[model samples]
Target: MPRVGLFITCVNDALFPETPKAVVTILERLGYDVDFPAAQTCCGQMHANSGYKKDAAKLARNFEAVFDPYDAIVTPSGSCAAMARDQCPHLTGSTIGRRVYELSEFLLDVAGVEDVGARFPHTVTYHPTCHGTRALGLGDKPIRLLRAVAGIELIDLPAAEQCCGFGGTFALKNSEVSSAMLADKCRHATDTGAEYLAAADNSCLTHIGGGISRLGRTPGAAKAPRPVHYAEILASTA
Candidate 1:
């Protein structure tokens, strides 16, 4: 085996540490020596999206410095990984941009591990982030991985390609539209009666999670709704 570095996004680090931990577990079981590089921060996605290319370049340098030694860099979030794989190339003329690899792409294209040996006995609906779909062009890789789960019932979301509107700053900048988009997503998730609304990006899940919480507290709901990351589910060996 090869050694890989887990580039846990800043938001996941601050608000959802479990996501990265789950990623680490999954990669370890797959036989890669996973390492975490301290001093890493946001991929500067917020800055890049905000049109601050200079700031993004600075963060890209940080990423290159921290991850250059590893054979591969894996991240549970598609958006951040896309930043490295897709967006970073635009910010610089350096070779760092060419070496970036998203987790889904790495697992499917590099490791050749289709069956992750994970098991989950719950109904699930996956929300594919825009970057994951458009930027990384990850079609069904997440679904393929989910289906390998021993007891999982992966339900198809009617408009799985739709955006969750949690485009980092998109939520704060356009709360009304973001709320509407999330409401639609939440309804579809509820329609599936899935115990979990799963996705690669926690940012989208966090947005949908808030709506799910509100819907859960409303009258006559059967139970609380919880959003789960795809990595967390896949990392499960139980």
Candidate 2:
């Protein structure tokens, strides 16, 4: 019965709108009252990563203004969730950061339910984004949720902890090195023979997905991996 604000991270809004819809639908099914303010936009992770702390601080204030009324805030992207959970507090001692919860973390802790009643008859592998793993310490929360899905065979991705090389603006700054890093991660995913490559961040998925599609076009290169955001998968059942 928690009142929650859904931070439909920028990328999810601009590119992957379905992700946030899935997030809202799932939260509703869990009996939580979720509100999505149309005024919400980018969490400023992109600006912060690019050394634009001032811009990020402004974005944080905007977030605080839009979301402070809720008991807690939840987001679909691990990167955005980590920013709210880990970075927003530094901008100001605003209560928003203290109350912010990533979707996986919220589902496992706040909602106190491991099984979200999702169903997917596909063999999938999970790739834990670095922020979800190291920053937020959301170990196995996603796995716990996905396992409860009715028909999914979730395989453990090889080197699942490795970065997909989409560290916000990391790919733009070092395209070659980023491409190399993603190639390795893609190879590991393909090696597992998983039909879908799942992760919590669409930004990372976009980057890795780009490499996957490019590789699919190349001779002898691996086929493209379908990147499924954790929220999108969860929404599938809702």
Candidate 3:
């Protein structure tokens, strides 16, 4: 068992702490020794992605210092993982950059295992975010794991590769355009009649989940698919 550190990104740490918790549960079940470095800060992704190169560089240096000691750095957010693997090397070096991995990529490629003995009896439709889809190129890894879950009914999301309109600050900078894109993704998710809509990135889940509930409100809106992190689903046994 290699020493592993969990990089609970700013969004997951602040808004969706349960995501990191679930990551711990799944890894522990697989006999992994997971560490959460207290000194760990945001991977400077928010700063870099928002065009603050100086700030991003500073935080990127800190990221290498805190995580370099570990054998592996795993994160639930594909976007955050991308920042570490794709951006940090230019700021720092290849030291820690080569060690970072998006959750599913680590599970399927590094760990060399697909089924984690998870069981969840619910219909689920997955939305692959831009980073996991384009940056990470995590095609079908998430879907492969979902299919292996004991009782999961995984359905295909229409326009599955389309963006969920939450590109971190992109949502804030282009609210109207973001909302329009979200509407299409949510419509496709709801049309599947799945109980929950899941994604590798919680930020995307937050956006599309909100749209499912808030789009086209009337006196009484119909039931919409719930938004949940696929990791949480993968961590389940019932």
Over 4 Å off, model 3:
none
List TM-scores for all candidates, in order.
0.95, 0.95, 0.96
* Runs in model 2 lying further than 4 Å from the true structure: 220-222
Angstrom error of the Cα, residue 97, model 2: value is 1.1
Q: Candidate 1 clash total?
A: 0
Cα deviation of 132, candidate 1, in Å: 0.4
Residue pairs in clash, model 3: none
Q: lDDT for every model?
A: 0.83, 0.83, 0.88
RMSD of each: 1.4, 1.5, 1.3
Count steric clashes of candidate 3: 0
Q: Candidate 3 versus the native: TM-score? A: 0.96
Error of 2 at 236 (Å): 2.2
* Top-lDDT structure, candidate number: 3
lDDT of 1 by residue, 61-153 (tens): 788788888777888888887788777778864465455666667778888887899988888888888988998889989888898889999
User: Among these predicted structures, which one has the highest TM-score?
Assistant: 3
